[model samples]
Target: MERKRGWDTLLSADTHHNAVGLLAREMRRASSPLYYPIALCLLRLLTREKTSWELPAMAFLVEALDCPDMTEWSDSILEILSRRLWSQCTEMHRLVLRGLVLLSKAPGMADGVRSLTPSLVELLCYTGGELVGMVLSVLINQVQDRDIPISTPTALRLAELLPPLFGYDNIHVQLLSIYLFQKVMELAVDKSKQLLKTHVIYSLLPLFFHWHHENQDVAEASRKALLRAAGLLKRRDLVKLLKTEQPWRFSECLLENDKRRAVEYACQALPYLESPQEPVREAALRFIGIAGRYMRGQRVELQVAINVIEDMTPDSAAVKSLALQTQEILRAVQRPQSSPGSSSLKISSRRCRIGRLLSGAAAGGQRRTYSGNPV
Candidate 1:
């Protein structure tokens, strides 16, 4: 019961790690009910005021896992742990994640895990390698075994962050990010399903591109995510196409229903023209062509797509043909030149922003390709 007296060594000594960790470890196995006070003592030391003490506190906390009463402190443990997952201190943050990982397995921890969605999604933007793998494994835990409802705001942020990761070099990241996205679609609050509609709409073409991924798992994940997206958008026709494995018609169906965003969708599809995989390039080129049909007066967006397509040097003859075919499709439909008296060609600020973004992505792709890295 006097466990608090031994806690000072955690903050003051370089030698306490082994002793504290060992004591915490042995406490978990002791016959008497002594672990809780020790665990509670460790938890109180996890504050920012004692930066030196935080890691030891978390380390001892982890060593005490499976202690008979661990779950009783879950909410507090989760609260403190969730706040530290973003710690700038690398080892501290990792220990926090490891603690959360163990804490998450206990019953009734779903709400705590659900609150973690935004943090994990945000972390995906900044971390990679083993850190990314760790964050993703924890994120996968968040959505599995039960429905962990995410807020509309979190869904919106996640929807934005997840698409770019569809091509992450790490196969695990690529796979987990896509799978988690589908759960976001399924478990987001019902009313926000409509709010998530626009994001879902934007994801269709990219998901379709990855559907041809060489990695069977990634391809399957993309397909499943696209299916969930279609269901969320209430596009039964598109759903039937995906369910039936008819990707060729899926792009056309998607554009036919949402023709208005053709310009936006086409811009999003432009960068995939440089994809190392021929099938992805071919899929992107094909979709851009169909999307071109809907771009009659979208002269600015049309020419932007053409400029990027012109940079494509085909890996296969079919890609070359599709490139030209798409060129012709876009060329034939571009609105005629302004009348003689017309002022400068007016472009929307929105289109200008899209143009800049596509150009930046294409440039990034080239730089990374030259360096043999994933953008």
Candidate 2:
């Protein structure tokens, strides 16, 4: 007890190396009850010291003392370390974080550290990529334990953290965040799964089709995770997800299936023709062309397509050409199937001429009234 009391005085007096040496010598005496006092002294020195040298000494002491026997001391140490996260010292934060990571890996230390989930979630918002990755690693390990379920609040906090990181600038941070997200989605219980679907799926859909991502591994992982999400979601839920998340998928799926429902949903792609993205506009026009074959005599749908085609510019010549062909096919299919004679063909030719005249007049901002009089 005298030697332990003297060691605390030495630790507080700025002689950190000598204090650490004494603590190490005392720690070697396995039966000594000096671990708690030594741990308390090191934690105090860790939190109070602003010097660079003492930080590593304190961290080294904590690491050296880490064992199953020291598990009971984890809560207090974690609390002090978590509080240190708010400090302005980056080195101190790094030391505490490294200490936490080491402690979390020790036998019987994970459960105690798991209680710090709220603190860990808050740390996820830390701007430092290293800090965020360490926090994610700790949480990932904790969640992998089936016996210890993550609470709803922690899960929700994690969901909030996921979106920004999915597009994070750092590749390692991006990959680790994604891996943590996948693990959470897979391990979440049924109730948590619903929360994820409601909050997360909308953000994930674009990644499934992010063909431009430089990293093939990230793109492939996103695609696989998206397919997994699709499997778990109901068809109606998926349709809802695609409507706002990736409307192109919804339209493409409708076009591929060609169900009766496709007719109603095919119109959804019309807005995409006016999208600023050239690819989106082209895809929209392509879907419309395919759907028009089944839309013969559907005057409303055909008229909508015509108006869209008329709005196109020379820049969209490919789209316009496809739309024009589709318009002709639709008009041909509108004629009565029994009326396949030359007269029907002449009518169709005259109708095309009248349609062109109307389109030209409309483009020139001219309006004409047909009062049962010859042109």
Root-mean-square deviation per candidate: 9.8, 14.8
| Per-residue lDDT of candidate 1, residues 1-375 (tens digit) | 136545565455664654566567667677337777867777766633556666667777877665656677777778787777788977677777777676667667767776777777789789876677677777668768767687788878888888788887788888888887898899889878888887887788778888877677888889889999988888899889878776666776888888888888888888888887776887787778778767878888888888899987656765675577677666756757456776554434434543444344334323422232111
Error of 2 at 182 (Å): 1.9
Q: What is the lDDT of residue 299 in candidate 2?
A: 76
Assess each prediction's global lDDT (C-alpha) against the native.
0.73, 0.58
Q: What ranges in model 1 sit over 4 Å off?
A: 1-69, 72-76, 115-121, 313-318, 334-375
Using TM-score as the measure, the top candidate is: 1
Per-residue error for 358 in candidate 2, Å, reads: 27
What 10-residue stretch in candidate 2 is worst by lDDT? 366-375
User: 284-363, model 2: which lDDT tens digit per residue?
Assistant: 55556556556656777777676776677655555465556555655554554445555777776866664563344322
Q: RMSD of model 1, in Å?
A: 9.8
* Per-candidate clash tally: 0, 0
Error of 2 at 101 (Å): 1.9
List the candidates' TM-scores in order. Answer: 0.71, 0.52
